[model samples]
Target: MTNHYYRDFLIRNWQERDRIPAAEVIRSVLSEYGLGWEPNGADKDVLQVEEYYLATGGEFWVIEYQNQLVGTGAYYPIKRSEKAVEIRKMYLLSSVRGFGLGKYLLQQLEAAIASRGFLSIWIETASVLAEAVKLYESNGYMPATGVETTRCDRVYVKSLMTNFY
Candidate 1:
């Protein structure tokens, strides 16, 4: 068995073989966040959203250990009056928890956004995703008032003042 900790995981652009495993990891994480998937209903919606993100200029960074995908972080431009981008889906398989990978992924995403001259990065997450909420908070994102979704999603925004590249 691969030791996830000792293995070198590369974070790179998404590929075709990554689709299914990435979807599965995200589905599992969403379930843990109380956003359970239903094959014929919400699950389909989730998949469609993923497809839409890919169709746009969205980029997915997949983490692999010994050729096995274990997590993903994606970002796409969101329609806004000001230059901004959104951090869409981000997930790490259970085995990689507590390894600082989340922070690493966020940093990369932020750098990519900033490099594009976007002034801010925004993200939304259901309230049940406490860990995600904390991650955003710790990374300088501030809560913003917005129309809540059926899933009680909360919006957070982080301003990127300088180019990180």
Candidate 2:
């Protein structure tokens, strides 16, 4: 239950009421990119944020622009390595794109991860998500393999041990 303000947007922890709207925002963004929304599959976590994220020692956030939910992002620990986390569900509506909020959200996520003593961060995204790829690369995430999600084709990893935070 934390709140972060950036310009006109408010980034805060996910709540029960945000489930539907946040799912809609994510589904809509995936649709805009011609990708399918896998509710029972890859995206089941969106329906059970508490169980998948909050309860599992991870964090989920919803982005509000003018009091409207416009984006979502989350991360949870994974068994891939020691003290590692995978960034998930980072989608922003087109209306909110190009405003650097995505980058800001990413920085916030990274700072939180680093502060929590996480040593590694991983991300998976599709190649069609060109903007996402550019953002990750620009933020020091090097290309990697072994993507675990069906919707993603590209993988990136970053070590939070240095120059991170």
> Which candidate number would show the highest TM-score if scored against the true structure?
2
Superposed by TM-score, candidate 2 places the C-alpha of residue 13 at a distance from the truth, in angstroms, of 0.5
lDDT of 1 at 147: 30
Which tens-of-lDDT digit does each residue in 22-136 have in candidate 2?
A: 9999999999999999999989999999999998889999999988999999999988879999999999999999989999999999988888889999998999989999999
Q: Give the Å shift of residue 164 in candidate 1.
A: 8.7
lDDT (0-100) at residue 44 of candidate 2? 97
Candidate 1 local lDDT, 5-124, one digit each (tens):
323777877767766777788888877666865546434423555565567766777788778888877777776538877786788877887888888788878877777688888887
Q: Name the lDDT value of residue 117 in candidate 1.
A: 80
Question: In lDDT terms, which candidate is top?
Answer: 2
Let me know the TM-score candidate 1 reaches against the reference structure: 0.81
Count of residue pairs whose backbone atoms collide, per candidate? 0, 0
Give all TM-scores, in the order shown: 0.81, 0.96
